[model samples]
Target: MTLFTGLAAVAHAQGMSVSSSAFADNALLPAIHAGAGDCGGTNTSPPLEWKNLPQATRSVVIKMTDPDGAKGGGVVHWIAYNIPASVLSLPAGAGDKSGDQITVGKNVSGAAAYRGACPPVGDTPHHYVITVTATDLDPGRLPPGLDAAGLAVALAGHTLNGSTIVARYGR
Candidate 1:
């Protein structure tokens, strides 16, 4: 089975769901969520909330990725983990370099903060999947500064449930 299929199954069984107040699933993201440099917009992370997490969850991890980026290999826009399970939501701009109850991870650019979508100019809109994972690990179980691959390896079989919301963005 595919990785996404597995995550969907877990989400379904656990009744977990994630949503964004800034944009609905499969909707276009606002310009404020775009990258600041060439993308020409404020780099702000959207507000996100999760509900019905599994009982085994001790912490939550959030990741945002653009599957069509980097010539189709994918790009990691944000990776923040070590969020206490008691925390159910992240306010807008929470993925910034510093935040409460969250430990930022390295994105594609090696920055330990959110790097908003910046798809190539003139390309079709890219689909950005933002996933929230409920895990059995403690809030401080993993060290900070982990990249996407490192975070995945650490999460491994510890993920109890997960949910995703997709947003579209273009240059």
Candidate 2:
């Protein structure tokens, strides 16, 4: 198996799972999580669930990125951090600012909110890698409004382990 496949197998064996109620693993994300505008979606955050996090975990950071966005690396769709370890799941539309359980960090769109897929029309479906990282960073200590790149830099030594669930979306 390839390294990714092997790692996925290992993660599965470890019982660390990140899942979504709106769709199955590797399935297409629902329209609620789709990007607004020409894509025509409500742009709500999909509900997410996780289990068997590492013992050292103190917080969590949930993010989503489109791997086939025709960009060099990928296009970040969401970056939400400061999630308490006690919280194992997020309800649909939880990314909204009001009554949100965690801090929704800045995304590629410069909005600190979930902005779903808006891939170019006629392009192949893009794989959106939704990752849930368990980390040791204290929410209070983290600077406010950190973007994906900034949070990634801060999570270097703090990350314990993570789970990834892939979903697809296209225009």
What TM-score, computed on C-alpha atoms, does each candidate reach? 0.91, 0.87
Local accuracy by lDDT, each model: 0.92, 0.82
Question: Number of the top candidate by TM-score?
Answer: 1
Off-target runs (Cα >4 Å) in candidate 2 are: 1-13, 98-100
User: How many backbone clashes does every candidate have?
Assistant: 0, 0
Any runs in candidate 1 off by more than 4 Å, and if so which?
1-13
lDDT of 2 by residue, 44-155 (tens): 8889999988766788888888878756478888888888889999998897542444888787878878887888887777898999998887655576688888987898
- Displacement of residue 150 (Cα, Å) in model 1 is 0.7
Predict model 2's lDDT versus the native: 0.82
Candidate 1 residue-wise lDDT, 1-171, digit = tens: 699998987766679999999999999998899899889668899899999998788999999999999999999999999999999998899877656689999999999988998999999999999999999999988898999999999999999889999999998
Top of the candidates by lDDT: 1
